[model samples]
Target: MMGSVAQLWRHPIKSHGREALEAVTLSVGQCMPLDRHWAVTHEASRFDGTGWVSCQNFMIGARTPGLAGLWARVDEEARRVTLTHRDLGELTFAPDDPAEAARFLDWIAPLCPENRARPSAVVSVQGRGMTDSDFPSISVMNLSSHRAVAQKLGRDIEPERWRGNIWLDGLGPWEEFEWIGKTIRIGSASLHVRKRITRCLHTAANPITGKRDTATLDALEVGWGHCDFGVYCEVIDGGDIRLGDKSEVL
Candidate 1:
C-alpha cells in the first residue's frame, strides 16, 4: 500500500504554537527544519543548551492547555516568530534574544497553571531540533487512523493534538505500526521507523480551544487497547518533502 503526504507542519517554538508548511526540507539525523529549534523553559527546569531535554521542562500544551490554541508562523531568515490566539490576539518576538524571553512569557502567562513553573526564558541550540523522543525525531501520523478514532468518538478531532511533522493519507487505520523497523521513502527523503508514538494528556486538549474535551486516550484504550496513535521516524536521507508527495514503505 502507498500513502501520500497530506500536510506538513513545523513548530518553530516548542509547545508554543504550530506553523503549517506547504513544503519542508528535511535532513538525515534532524527533525524538520526550524521545528522545535526554540523552547520556553520554565522556572526551576534545568535544560542546558548542550543536549536534548525532556518536554516536561518546557511550557507545553499538556501543562499549559491554552498553548494548544496557539497558531504560529516563523520567518527563518529573519529569526522571527509570530503567535496568534483567539483570546490573546497576536504577538511577534525574536526567540533568540535574552531580552525578548520575558515578553514571550508575559504573553503566555495567562495559560500557565498556578502550580506549574512560570515561564522564565527561551532556549535553543542552533543545529539541533529538540524533540519528544530522546533521539532526534520526525513525528508521522496516519490520517485514516485519525478518522477511525473520530468514528469511535462519534465526532471529529484535530490532528494538531498529535503535533506531528508529517500527516499521511491513503493508509489503513493503525497501518503505520507495521512500518516499524522499516525504511519509508517519502518524496525525495527516506526515514527509518523508530517506534510507535505513545499518547499523552495533550491528546485530550482541543487544538483550537485547549480544553480537555476529547477522551482520546480512553478511545484508544477502548478501541485498540493501547494509548498509541502515531509513529516516530529518523531521517535517513535528506531531501525536500512537499504536499502530496508519495510516501512508501521501502
Candidate 2:
C-alpha cells in the first residue's frame, strides 16, 4: 500500500466551484462522477457543444481569480448544485435549466472582470467531462508532496488550491511521479496513471480568499524545477472508491 485515500473532491461546474465527496462510484473510461459535468462558456467562446473544447473558451480561475473562492454542494440525484462564496452568499439551481443558468450568469457576473469575455451560457458534452486533458482523466494528489511544497514555501498550503479529484496520504514527497504509466488500485477500482498534471496560474489563487496570495508556480519551479503537482489517471476497471480506502500500485 502506497497510501490511503485522504480526501475526494469533484467540480460539477468546471472552474466554478469544488465539492467534497466521501465516496463515489467510478466508471471505466469516464471521469469521476459529475466532475466538470458543466462549464460556463464566455460570449466569445466558439464552443458549439459538439465536442470537448479548450479551457480558454470558458471563465476560469486562471483568468478570473475570484472564482477560486467559490465552494459547492451537489445533489447528484436532483441534478442540482448549491454554490457559496464569501461575496455571494448562496444559490441553489439546476445548471441544465436554461432559466436558472441565466440567473447563475447574472449572479456570478460580479466576480468576473469587465475586460474579459462575459460568461454567456452553461454547457455540457454528453457522456464526457470538460477536463483540462483531452481524454477523460481523474487527478490524484499526494499529501506528502503538498507538505513538501508547503515546507519549501515556509507556510501551510491548502489542498483545495490543486483542485484534484483524489488525495492520498502516506507516500513520500514526489513519489507519485514514479507511478507514471503504471496501474494503481484504490478501493475496488483500478486506474492507469497517464501523465503529470502541469499546473497553471489558477493554483496561485487562494481558495479561501480567492486572491493571488502565493507564487505556487514559482515555488514548484524553484523547489522541483517543474510546475506539476499531481498525476492524471484513467480508470481501467470501475468500482467504488471511498475515503480511507487503501491505494496500492499494482
Candidate 3:
C-alpha cells in the first residue's frame, strides 16, 4: 500500500466553494459526482454552457482570492447547494434555476473585485464537469508534499488551498509525481495518473481568510524548481472510495 485516503473534497461550482466528503462513488471516464457540475461565467466569457470550456472562461479564485473562503454543502438529489462564507453568511439555492442563479450572482458580488469581469450566469453542460484538465480528471494530493511546502514556508498550510479532490497520507514528499503514466487503486477504483497539476495563484490564497497570505508558488519553485502540488488522474474502473481506504500502485 502506498498510502491511505485521508481526505476527499469536491467543488460543486467551479472555483466557487469546496465541500468535504467521507466517501464517494467514482465512475469510469467521469469526474467525481457533482464536482464542478456548474460554473459561473463572467461578462467577458464566451462560454454559453454548450460544452466543456477552459477554466479561464469562468470567475475563479485565481481572479478573486476571496472566493477561496467559501464553504459548500451539496444536496445531490435536489441538485442544490448551500454556500457559506464569513462575509456573506449563507445562501441555499439550485444552480439550474435562473432565479437562484441571479441571486447567487448578487450574493457573491462582494467577493469579486469590482475591476474584474462580473459573474454573468451560472452554466453547466450535460454529463460534463468543469475540471481544469481538458479531460475529466480527479486531483490526487500527497499529505507529505503539502507538509514539505509548509515546512519551506515556515507556516502551516491548509490542504484546501490546493483544491484537490483526494488527499492521501503515508507517501513520501514528491512521491506522487512518480505515479504519472501509472495506474493506482484506491479502494475498489482504478485511476490512471495522467499528469502533474501545476500550481496557480489560486493556491496562494488562504482558504480560511480568502486572502493571499503565502508565497506558495514561489516556495514550490525555489525549493523544488517546480510549482506543482498534485497529480491529475482519470478513472479507469468505477467503484467506491472512502476515507481510510488503502491506496496502492497497480
Candidate 4:
C-alpha cells in the first residue's frame, strides 16, 4: 500500500554526489537533470563492448568514501549545475558546455587517484563510457521496505545506501511488495512498481563517508536471508515529485 512520498533525491554524478530537491518536473525520454549524466571512466575497463565493467565495479564503493559526500545544486534557469563538497569549493558549470566538461575533468581528476592522468575521459557508447540503466530514467523506492530491512538487520540502514532517485514515506515495512506490478501515483508522477531491489556490496558501503559498512549485510544474512532492502520502479507519467507528495497505490 503506497502512502505518501517521504523524500526525493537525485545524484548528478554517478557515485560522486547527490542532490536532494523539494520538487522536480520530469519529461519523457530524459532523466532528471544532472542525474548520472556524467561519469569518470577508464579505457582499460569494459561495460563498453570491450567487456562487462562499470564505475560501481571500481572506486565507487571501494576507495573513496568521501565520494558519497559530494553535493549538487541545479540552476534550472541558467541550465547550469553546481557541485560542492566540504574540502572542495563550489564549482558551477553548464551541463552542455564543452568547457564545463573540461573543468569537471580538471576539478575532479586529482580528487580520486584513479582518474589522475586520464581524467578528461567520457563514457559514450558512441564516444567514451556507458550510460545509466534502462529507458526508465528515474528510480523510485518504498520507505516502509527500508524500515523492514532495518528491523530485520536489527540496526538502522541509511537511505543513501540504496541510492534511489526517490524515497516514499508512510508505508509499512514490506508493504511495497504488495504494489509490485501495480501503478502508483506519486505527486504528479506515476510509476509502475516493478521489483525488489537486490543488494550489492555497495549497500555495505556507507554513502556518507564511503567506508564499507558490513553491518547491513551481516544483518541481512542473519535475519532476512539476503541483503534485499527496497523496491525499484519506473516513471510512467513524468512530473514533479516532492517531499510530501501523495503516493497512493492504484
Candidate 5:
C-alpha cells in the first residue's frame, strides 16, 4: 500500500503568497493552517455585495509578470504580514489595523494596471466582500499526478504552477483520484477525499516566473484526457501533520 506524507503547503495570503511547511496541525474542517486566511480584493469592493472574485482576476500570471517576484511572510502570532518585491524592501501590515487593508490595496495597484479601481480601495479576504471562487476551502496535491503531467509535458513543471495548498509526494500516479469518497490518515488527523481539482488558466501560468505557458495544461489534456492535476480533501480527524507522516488509505 502507498504510504507517507509527502508534502505540506500553506498560502498565508489568498492568491498572493504561499509557504511550505515541514509540519502542521489542523482542526476538523479547518483550512490548511493559515492557507488562504487572507486575500486581496479590488479597490472599490464589498465582499457580500459582490460575488466571489475568480483568481484569474488577479494573480501572478501573463497579466502581471511582476507578481511572480512578490514574496510575503506572515507573523501569525504578531498578527502582522510583510510583503517584499525586488525593487521594494518590506512593507508590513497589522492584520487588525482598519487602515491596513487599504495599504495592501495601494501596494498591489501600481503593479496591477489592468485593474481600474483606485489604489486606496483595498480589501481583505475576511472583509465583507471576498470569497474563493469555489469550495469553502482548498488543500494538497498528489506528487505522482503532478509528475505524470510533467512527464507528458516534456518539461520540468514547478508546483507553484498548480498552487496547491498541500503537495503529497508518495502516492501513485493519479492515485489521489481513487482517494475520492475515502478517508485517509495523516499523522493523527484524517481527511476525507472529496473530488478532483480540475485545471484552469492558472495551470498555464508558470508558478515561479509567473509567465503564461499553456504547455502544462496541454500535456494534461492530450495525455490524461482531462485538465485536472490535483484532488481536494476535507479534514476529518484533526492532528499535527508533519513531513514524512504515514498516510494510509482507509
Candidate 6:
C-alpha cells in the first residue's frame, strides 16, 4: 500500500519545542532544512560546535521530559525563534546572540530537573542538522503504527512524542522497517531508508503537559519486545515534499 504524507515537523531548538510546516524542501545529503538548527548546550557539555556530539552533550527531553511542553516558532528569514510555554508565556530572540541565550536560560531554569546539569547557551553548526544519527536523517513515521502503539497503551498516543520530520498514513504498523536498504518516493523527492529509530524516554513525555504520564517504552517493550517506532532515511533526490503528498516504496 502506498502511504501519503500526513504531517511534517521541525525542531529548530532540540528538545525544547516543535514547529509544524505545511510543506518543506528536502535537499540531498541533508535533513529537513532548519530542523535541529540549534541546540541548548548545558554547562557540563563539551560540544564546541565543531562536529556532531552525542545527544548527552545537550539538553534533551529524555533527561527533562517537561521540555516537551514548550512550543517554538522559527522565522528562518529573520533567524529568530519564538518559544512559548503554558507557564513561561512567550520569548522571542535570535538563538546565536549571547544575550538572547542568557534570557532563554533564565526562562527555563525552573523547568530544569534538579538531577541534570544547568543549561549554558544555545548554539549551532552551519549546514548540519543535529540529528540522532551521525549522518543526516529525515524520520518517517506511519500513522497506522502510531495507532497500533496507542492500542497497546489502551489510549491515544500523541504524534508529537515521536518528534519525526515527516509522518505518513495508510501503511501497516511498523511496515516502514521493511523498506530499509530500499528507495522510496515522496512527491518529487526520493529517500533511501537506512535505519529504524529506537524509542526513548522522550516518547514518555506529554507534549501538552511535558510530564512523564505515559508508559510508551513499557508498552513497546511488552507488545513488540523492542523499542522502535520509525525509520530514518537519507535524502537521495531533492525536491519539495508537502503535506498530503504521495509516498510509495520503490
Candidate 5, superposed: residue stretches over 4 Å from native: 43-46, 49-68, 87-89, 115-135
lDDT of 4: 0.64
Task: Score residue 241 of candidate 1 by CA lDDT.
Answer: 93
Clashing pairs in 1: none
lDDT of each: 0.90, 0.95, 0.94, 0.64, 0.66, 0.91
Residue 132, model 6: lDDT of 85
TM-score of every model versus the real structure? 0.98, 0.99, 0.99, 0.77, 0.83, 0.98
Error of 2 at 188 (Å): 0.4
C-alpha lDDT of residue 17 in model 3: 91
In what order do the candidates fall by lDDT, top score first?
A: 2, 3, 6, 1, 5, 4
- Compared with the true structure, what per-residue lDDT tens digits does model 5 show for residues 1-250? 5567776767666556556678887788667766766555444544442445665443433345445545667787897878776555568887457688667766766666465543333334442222243644545578888788887777777777777766677678988888888888878888888878776665676555555765776788889788886777778778988888787788
- Cα miss at 7, model 5 (Å)? 2.4
Give the per-residue Cα lDDT of candidate 3 at 148. 96
* Tens digit per residue, CA lDDT, model 2, 146-243: 99999999999899999999999999899999999999999999999999999999999999889999999999999999999999999999999999
lDDT per residue, candidate 1, 163-248, as tens digits? 99999999988999999999999999999999999988888998888788999999999999999989999999999999999999
Error of 2 at 195 (Å): 0.5
Candidate with top lDDT is 2
lDDT of 1: 0.90
Least well predicted 10-residue stretch by lDDT in candidate 3: 46-55
Clashing pairs in 3: none
TM-score of 3: 0.99
Please give me the total number of clashing residue pairs in predicted model 1.
0
Which candidate, 1 or 6, would have the higher TM-score against the true structure? 6
